[model samples]
Target: MVVKSHKIHDVEMVEALKEARQKIFTEIRKVIIGQDQVIEELLISLLARGHCLLIGVPGLAKTLLISTLAKVLRLKFNRIQFTPDLMPSDITGTEIIEDDHSTGKKVFKFVKGPVFANIVLADEINRTPPKTQAALLQAMQEHEVTAAGTTYKLKEPFFVLATQNPIEQEGTYPLPEAQLDRFMFNLWVDYPSEQEEIQIVQYTTSAYSGQPQVVLDAEDITAFQDLVRRVPVATNVVDFAVKLVRMTRPNFDQSPKFVKDWIAWGAGPRASQYLILGAKTRCILDGRPTPEIEDIRAVAKPVLRHRLVTNFNAEAEGVDTIEIIERLLEKV
Candidate 1:
């Protein structure tokens, strides 16, 4: 009887998740035209409770997509524009001296910055210096900020969606490998299709502004994230994910000859972890009870793209990381 009851409950949850997924896409379409893959990946990352780094050229609607999703989430969203002169205090807040008028005494007060919010958009994150960029490291990993030797806890469901302009290398501070590895999915926002581009122009040029409805609150989102973790994976699926990550290392004996020749560095254990988590999230989002090998393959590109480093020979041969990943996917 207990097993039957559990099966019924799981069925209900799966149905509810499917309905919510459709509704979210419906609402997002009002503001965002096309880029269904991008939106789906964003939802997957959120469900996995992982941070995302969006890489694209200017005017690709990366910021707009994030803000639109924020509206639907009904979470406190803070947009921080990273610039050269921006200080760490600008993001993580600082201590300021203030006079306690009642006591006529000066006291130091901690001022929270944009990082205090539930959803933080680090716009043009590469424009800022490494010192200022490093400020986010603690928050992204720890979900809390240490100010004035005092640590303050962040609100639940804290997510950072940082954007980077890939075309412009001038005057931009490249994120170090360690920092880059912190992001679970380094998503690339591509330009819209020709028809989609026309639709975008028609909507933006006119006053046909979209009003997105709030579909899921923080509590509901938190529940979904928990549900993603609860989804089960087969032993073979887990082994496949682990092996795929290990095969990326050029030094690994199991790595292919092409990988050893074209790769400088391979993905770490975190990649394997995210591959499973992302696969679980993807499976649940599709209303599947158990993750399949296809789920892992679907998420491999975004999860491993930034983690793999190609050598100069690959670059000289006009090969990109994504191509190498595709070859790895085919072979592995």
Candidate 2:
């Protein structure tokens, strides 16, 4: 009887998840014209409780997409435009001295910054210097920020959706390796197609104004995140993910010659962890019971792209990380 009841619950949860996915897409489509893959990856990262880094040239609607997502999710959203002169205190709140009239004394109060929001969009994150950029590291990893020696827990289901302008790097500071690894997926938001561009122009140039309806709240997001954690993974799937990550390391015995020749540093264990977790999330999001190697393959590029560091020889030879990753995928 208990087993039967559990099975029934699982079915109900799956149905609810499927419905939620459709509802989310419907709401987002009202504002966004296309970029289906980008939307799917963003949803996967959200369900997996992971942060994302969006890379694209300007005017691609990267900021718009993230803001619209926050609206659909009905989370408190904050946008921090990172600048060169921005300080760490700008992102994370600082302490201010306050006068207490009743006690006739002054007390220091910790004022929260934009980082306290449920959905934080760090627009042009690379524009900030390293000191300002590192401000997000603690919040992303620990989910808590320390201000004036007092730790404050952020709201549940916190996410940092950072954007970077790929075409312009003249005055921007490149993110450090340690900080880059914190992101689960480094999604590239490409330009729209010819037809899609026409649609965008028609929609924007017209008097059409549409707002996305709220699809999910904090509780729903928390539940889905927990559900992603509960999703089952097969042994073979886990093995495949591990093997793929291992093959990226040049020093690993299982690594190929291309990795040793073109790659300077390989993905760390976090890549393997994200691969399996992302695969499991992708499986259930597609209404499957268990993850497969194909799911892992689908998430491999985004999960491993930012983690791999290419050598100077590769650049001289016009070789990129994608080529190395594709070769590894073929061999593994």
Q: Which stretches of candidate 1 lie over 4 Å from their true place?
A: 1-10
TM-score of 2: 0.96
Q: What local lDDT score does residue 280 receive in model 2, on the 0 to 100 scale?
A: 80
lDDT of 1 by residue, 160-200 (tens): 99999888889999998889999999999988999999999
lDDT of 2 by residue, 154-193 (tens): 9989999999988888999999888999999999999999
Q: At residue 186, what lDDT does model 2 achieve?
A: 96
Each model's number of backbone clashes?
0, 0
| Residue 24 in candidate 1, Cα distance off native in Å | 0.6
Candidate 1 clashing pairs?
none
